[model samples]
Target: MPQLLMIEDDARLAQMVGEYLEQSGFVLTHATDGKAGLALLEAPTAAGLPDLVLLDLMLPDMDGLEVCRRLRALPSDAARLPVVMLTAKGDPMDRIIGLEMGADDYLPKPFEPRELLARIRAVLRRRGEAAPSARIMRFGSLEIDRDARTVTVAGEAREITSYQFDLLAALAERAGRVLTRDQIMEAVRGRELEAFDRSIDVHMGRIRAAIEADPKNPKRILTVRGVGYVFARQQD
Candidate 1:
C-alpha cells in the first residue's frame, strides 16, 4: 500500500482524516508533532519512505516550515519526498511560504475531505518516480519526446492534450517505478496550485483510453495494486 505519514497537532482532525483515508485504501501513519514526523522519515525501511506527508504548520516541538526546510536540506535522495501542508491558517501568505519552502501542495483549514483526497492524488501524479527528462523515456510501443511534448506510438506522431502529455511523460519518465497518486499530481502540477481539484486516476483513465490498444487490459500503464500506478516498460 502507499504509506503516508501525517504530522498534525490536532488529534481529532488527524483521526477523522485518518479514518476517512483508511476507507479510501491508503495506509495512514500518524505523528503527533513535527519532531516525530521527522524521526520516522529519517529511518525509512526497504519499502522506501512514506509515499507522501500530510503536514500541519503548527506543531508542539517545532514550526512546520522549519521541518520542511530541514527535510529539503537533507542530502539523500529522500530530499525528493513530497509534502502537503495542511493547516487551519488559510492565509495566502502561509500557502505561498509553504510552497516556497519546498512543500508540494498546501491545503487550508476547514477544507473538505474530498479536496484533501484530490490534492493527495495530484501530488502523487506530479512526483511520478521517473528519471530526469534529460534521460530518454520509452514504454513499449510509445516513445516520448520530453522537450518537444510529443509522443510517437508505433513510430508515428500522435496529438495529445497538454495534461495528457504531462501525465504520460511522468509515467514514461519513471518507466519501471511505481508512482503514487500524490507523487503524480505533484509532478504534473509542479509548484503552482494550492489544491488538486481533479482526480489523477480519471486523468490516467483518459490517457489509457487514448494510448492503450486495450484500455480494459492496459499494457503501457498498470495499476500497482494498493500502492498507485506504474508504467511498464514492456507490454507483454
Candidate 2:
C-alpha cells in the first residue's frame, strides 16, 4: 500500500480524510503543522518517506509555500517527493503558485472525499507507472527516464514537478508531432483541461526553463500559433 503524509491544522478534517483514504487501501499519517511535517520528512521514520504529501496552503507555522520550497531543496530523494496542495483559496493564482512551488496537483477546500481520493490515486499512478515503451528516452542532450521519472539536460538533472514531467514526456515521446491543447491534456493523466485553462502553458514554460538553453526562445519545444506545441526532434 502507498503511504501518505498530510500536513493540516484542521484535526477533524485530517481525521475524516485519513479515514476516507484508509478505506481505499492507503495508509495516511498526519501532522498538525508545517514544522512537524518538515521534521518528519527531514528524518524519515522506520516507514521511510511517504509516497506523496498532501500539503495545505495555510499551515499554522511556516506557510505551505515556504514549506514546499524547502521540501524541494532537500538533499535527498525526498526532494522529488510528489506533492498535492490542498488550498481553501479559489484563486487560480494560488494553484499556479503552488504548481510553480513544486506541487504535482491541487484540490480546493471542502472537496468531496471521493474527489480527494481520485486526485491521490491519479498522482500516485503517474509517479509509479513506467511506460511499456522504452524506459529511458533520449533526445540529443535531453533525457527522459520513464522508470525513474526524471529528466536531465546534458547529463544534469533538471527539476520539474511530476505532472510537468509527464507533459514533457508526452511531447518528447511524440517529437516533431504537433499536439493540440486538448491532445496534450488527454496525454497527461491526473486532471482535465478545465475552462480558462492556462495550466498547460504554465507547465510548458516551466519545462522549457528546465530543459532549454534559453527559455525565451526554446528549441526543444516549439509553439504553433493558434494550434499547439511540438517537441523538436533534434536539439542543439
What is each predicted model's overall lDDT from 0 to 1? 0.79, 0.85
lDDT of 1 by residue, 1-236 (tens): 56788999898999999999988878788899988888777765333467788999989899899989988987654577889998877789988999999999988888898999989988888877453356446666777887787887788887777887888887776554578778777777763432553467777888888778899998778887677788765543
Return the number of clashes found in candidate 2.
Answer: 0
lDDT of 2 by residue, 13-81 (tens): 999999999999888889999999999888775445687999999998878999999999987657888
TM-score of each: 0.55, 0.56
Off by over 4 Å in 1: 45-47, 129-236
Q: Which ten residues in a row are the worst by lDDT in model 1? A: 190-199
Cα error of candidate 2 at position 177, Å? 40
lDDT of 2 at 52: 90
